[model samples]
Target: MTSRHHNLQHLKNQAYQDPLTGLPNRRSLGDYLQTALDRLHRHAGQAVVMFCDLNRFKEMNDTYGHTVGDRLLVAITKRLQAALRPDDVLVRFAGDEFVVVLEQCGSRQQALAMAHRLKKQVGSTLHVDTAVLQPRISIGIAMTSDPLTAAADLLHQADLAMYRAKRQKGDSVEIYDPVLDD
Candidate 1:
């Protein structure tokens, strides 16, 4: 590749990737969601959008400091990645928040099962320097077979569900229901 081409690629990566965890950043999520939604429109299958937030992460960060907190986020990212399929897009949406878009998911049951697997993988104990922490997560899932559903709307549903899960229990999964908005 030409030097200019390499530089452009590097810039794109920096723009789309989260520096702390090397996961796709929120900017990448918008593009990936559009593509995933398009693929779902052509194919007859359900796509799942999961909003995952780490429970008590703020307390951990405050207690340990950013260095340890950053390491913990990186560790959590690896575990979540390992539990997901290659086709899935995982984005580091914000601090202690991640968005996972699963394309071609078979059903709501499959999405729920995947959410359980993610919770299990991320709940494992971690040792970052002197801090031994047990990380937990709350996942909110929104599944859609309708091609008309906007990506932002779907993500908003999942975010609402996540807040419900966080309120009901610290580390749990909640599937989005229309009633959640009410």
Candidate 2:
């Protein structure tokens, strides 16, 4: 490829990727989710936005220092990516938080199933460098029928559900239910 083409590709990579995890950043999540929503609208499918957070990484950072924490983040990212379908979109939202876009789930149960898988994968402990770290992810899920629902709103709903999960004792995944909106 031409140097100019390479440079542009590099730039796009930087724009879409998280500096730490090398996963797609939230900058790309909006566009991807919007496109998925549009496709769902056309084909009569369902789309879900999942808010993911790695629990207790801050405590790890405090005990092990930032460098280990960074390595742990990368390892955690690897586990998350490995747990997902090849076509799924994963984003590093901040610190240890991630967002996943799941396409074409027929019902909230199906979406919840994916969420359960994610919770299981992320909740498992993995060895990072010299330290053995167990990181659990709390998930928030939002399902939409219409393309018109704002992307930010969908994310917000998922985030709220994730927070709800966090409030429960262990690794948890909660779907956005309007009644639970808080």
RMSD of each: 1.1, 1.7
**Residue 79, model 1, lDDT:** 97
**Poorly placed runs, candidate 1 (over 4 Å):** none
User: Whole-model Cα lDDT per candidate?
Assistant: 0.93, 0.84
TM-score of 1: 0.96
lDDT of 2 by residue, 45-94 (tens): 67889998888878988988899999988887887788788767888988
Could you tell me the lDDT of residue 128 within candidate 2? Answer: 66
Backbone N/Cα/C clashes per model? 0, 0
On residues 10-60, what C-alpha lDDT tens digit does candidate 1 reach at each position?
999999999999899998897887887888768988888999999999999
RMSD of model 2 against the true structure? 1.7
- Give the C-alpha miss distance for residue 153 in model 2, angstroms: 1.0
